[model samples]
Target: MDHLIEFWPILKRLIKYAIPWKKKIILAFCLLISGATSEVLGPILISYFINNILSKHKFYFQSTLIIIAIFIILQILAVFFNYFQSIYFNKIAVRVINKLRNDVMNSAIKQPIYQFDSQPIGQIISKVTNDTEVIKELYDTVAPTLFRSITLIIIILFAMFTLEWHMAIIAIFIIPLVIVIMSIYQYYSTPLLRNVRYYLANINNKFNETINGMNVIQQFRQQNRFKKSIQNSSQLHYLARMRILKLDGFLLRPLLSLISALVLCSFIFSFSYFKNEVFEVGILYAFITYLGRLNEPLISITIQQSILQQAIVAGERIFSLIDSKKQEYGRNKKRFKTGKINIKNLSFSYSENQKNILNNINIDIPSKSFVAFVGHTGSGKSTLANLLMGYYPIKHGEIYLDDKPINSISHCVLRKNILIVQQDPIILADTFFSNIALGRKISEDEIWKILKIVNLFSLVKSMPKGLYSILGEEGNTLSVGQKQLLSIARILVKNPKILILDEATANIDSGTEKLIQKTLSFIKKNTTLIVIAHRLSTIVDADLIIVLDKGNIVEFGKHEKLLKIKGCYSKMYNFQLSKY
Candidate 1:
């Protein structure tokens, strides 16, 4: 009730996630009603047994037996209703949460490439795992318990007024006092619990950062600093909990019990002053029984209020992710017949305030021609390659694939035709065969043939499990060069019409470079090959060498032709030659 108006929209958004389980929710509500009816009748049946048997001093055997049987029947009915309620609610809770988790993950996976570059992996993962788990209480326990508690309170209040209005007046009058206590408790505790959730996410993000960068942390001896950061985050989370603990220790349970005592003492005072026959001790007993029952739900509602606070915070985070922009794919599904790529006055930068990484560039790469983009570091060679792969939207200039705008081509068609092999391989923690084929229907024979083309067949064939051996999470078993070769084998299996090797061999040794160079020579025969390289010697045989400096291409021609001009390319070539 603290922010009920603002909370309603979030509640409504969360409810939509449960729409598919509406029938189950309705059935669970029916069971809850039945259970609450049984709960209310408990006080009534006990009242009747005490009033009739004790007050009249005449116990009819049949009447006493009937009351006993009704008591047993109420209890048995309660057990059945509770059983079905738990069954239906729990089942639907898990299903709804599973769907929500899936939607969050799918949204994360399909975000724009730049999102992964800018957003922390830990932050994204915390929203999916930690925040979603907190929101889960909306279904798992809080929703059903909140429903049953409110229904039982209503039933109990109804019975109290009907049986003895005088005592009921005293009991009901204290509810506003209890509501005030709750509102006060909520006022302080909401922000505390919210801080708790926030710090929990901070811990998640920090811990994730710590584990992922453990190598860097150790290499630079920054472990102590990272430890301090994690400890600070954990301490903040602990402080938030201590505040909630202070509130819970003194405010809620004790205050509600005090009100409960007041309700009971007021009943005793009325009994002492009023006429003896006018007040049946049985009614007083039943009223006390209902008062005791009232105590738990009141405290529970307070607890549920705190849970609602957490859920609101978690829901906002979750829906924010679901509402974030997803990667766009064009509607057209046209396929490129050849590998011809054209660029006209291409220029781009990551942000508006930043300088362009590629500037006023123009080039034409014919089908199946070998083109190398050679530049010093920060000259935008790799950025241009990423743009050509349709990794970013064409903002500053036009890129055409067979005379059609790149955005007009379908992602499926584009991905099927173009591939990029990065400098570092991304090996899954699975078998080599699975890594290469990755759930495709390529045959074992065809896979072996492709591996042979990359000169890895004999190496794989001599292993213990051959292609079936599981790779480590980082592919620690394979050398850098071997990993690059395996990545190329993946491209060969797909056999894209175009391949861009973005510094794919920059990290390998010279001995391994010859092997990769041989593989590239074989690949250049069939596809339009583009190489973004730091090493000068690797691209000397390139049909066209494009040299860039400060986002502008300063030279473009055959390697020997550029060398003859004694420009930036020749200087870089001479620098590398002196180093070797």
Candidate 2:
């Protein structure tokens, strides 16, 4: 009862998904009740025949045949009703799970960037796939079985009362005993099931991380380490399941069967001693038959407790994800007029407890200007760019795009105006046209023009199908330089107001770097270019360069002005020059 109270909200949310199919669910239940009625009537008809016909020493052949035929038909109707009920219930279950899986995925994609930073990708995947699948089992099997078992119990109790009220009262006591057993199981098993789910999610996270970093692991000979890690996670999951199994072995069927036997003995002994009427063989037979039949549903209810607990755990996980706060966006429809950006006293940390990744700093970027930010690793270069793109909420200070607060802008306007190309750009396994256009209906001629602008025209012309040819998974068919150039083409096609290149030229060969440089020179006239520079030579011609150290802006000027000052920017440039 306590566990039900604690999880009532989650259970209510799961029921809402089924509310849309209420009519079908109602029809299924009607079928279930009809079947249970037919099943209960069978025993009563036989008891009447035994008492009035055989025991009275008067057997009518035609009457007995009719009774036997009616009994057979009742049993057949029960089977038929059960079959159709199962069909309807299963159909509803499949549809509910499909909608739930889609909703989980949609919520996942809309989560804030920081959410992903805190939650592993694999754990999210487990919630969508593994956890939801368990929930489906709840609807498909556990729910229906419990409902059928309960309907049978109720109808059988009614039948027992009609025959003999004394025994009926004794039979009803099984319900409270069953409820007590279920409550005990819930108290002990809920925490264990939760641990099992947590370990399962951890195992999935470990596998995902290992697979993504397989090359690194092999190079460092860390295979054994990862294997042990996964083995430990699996062992924990196994132990939790084993503990539940031990609980089930002690508490579920065997215990319920014992209660059934004890109840039957007390019922028989009381009927013989307390009643003043003479012994009737038919009454004894009917009472014993009803009591024996009652045990089946009682045992079934106990057996379903484990599945119910699992479903509740899975539901809690899925609902927590679905109910988490999505990325907040305002409804302001104002569009960017000049693409100018101003940052005033801006400071940010990923979380409250940590020190700021970008300290109190200030800068203004003019429209259509070529600007560069240079810093060593962890100097908050990418963090600033992330802030500008509105990835994280600004708490300490303000950021304005085109003189309007960035947060006040609507999601559509913000995304359409400001775009960033990361150091490692994501390339899907798709055609050249699809990758570049990104589901937009750009003409082939326009795509060809952008391709030529990025100097990828020759490579596409060499392909068998040109624009329609598939890029292998993660664009494995293309070199890293080619992938980087392709990503640049993707941005240019959109013609965003602001374009950020975060170390885009870091790993590419010099030839590709030179091509990117040339491409940047072409687009700098119209697009506001913000480059997080890796090769300082690539940004020597910028209108301004800002140098950062420990999240503070230590120097800012043009190339010659900064060089004459011989500050952080000059030292970084000379260091790269010396290395080359």
Per TM-score, the best of the predicted structures is 2
TM-scores of the candidates are: 0.94, 0.95
Candidate 1 residue lDDT tens string, 320-366 = 88899987767668777888999999999998899899999999999
Work out candidate 2's RMSD over C-alphas: 2.0
Off by over 4 Å in 1: 1-6, 59-62, 174-191, 247-251
Assess the local accuracy of residue 477 in candidate 1 as a C-alpha lDDT between 0 and 100.
86
In order, the Cα lDDT scores of the candidates are 0.87, 0.89
Q: Which residue pairs overlap in candidate 2's backbone? A: none
Candidate 1 lDDT score relative to the true structure: 0.87
lDDT of 2 by residue, 1-580 (tens): 6687856777777888998999999999999888888888888889889888988999899999999999999999999999999999899999999999999999998899989988999899999989999899877788788898998888888888878787788889989999999889989999999999889999999999999899999999999999999999999999998999999999898899899899889877876787546435676678788777888888888878888788889999988898899988777888778879899999998888999888888999999999999999999999999988888899999998889898899999999888998888888999999999998879999999999999999999999999999999889899999999999998887788899999999989999999999998888878899999999988989998999988999999899999999888878889999999
Q: After superposition, how far is residue 223 of candidate 2 from its true place, in Å?
A: 1.1
How many backbone clashes are present in model 1? 0
Best by lDDT: 2
Off by over 4 Å in 2: 54-59, 270-279
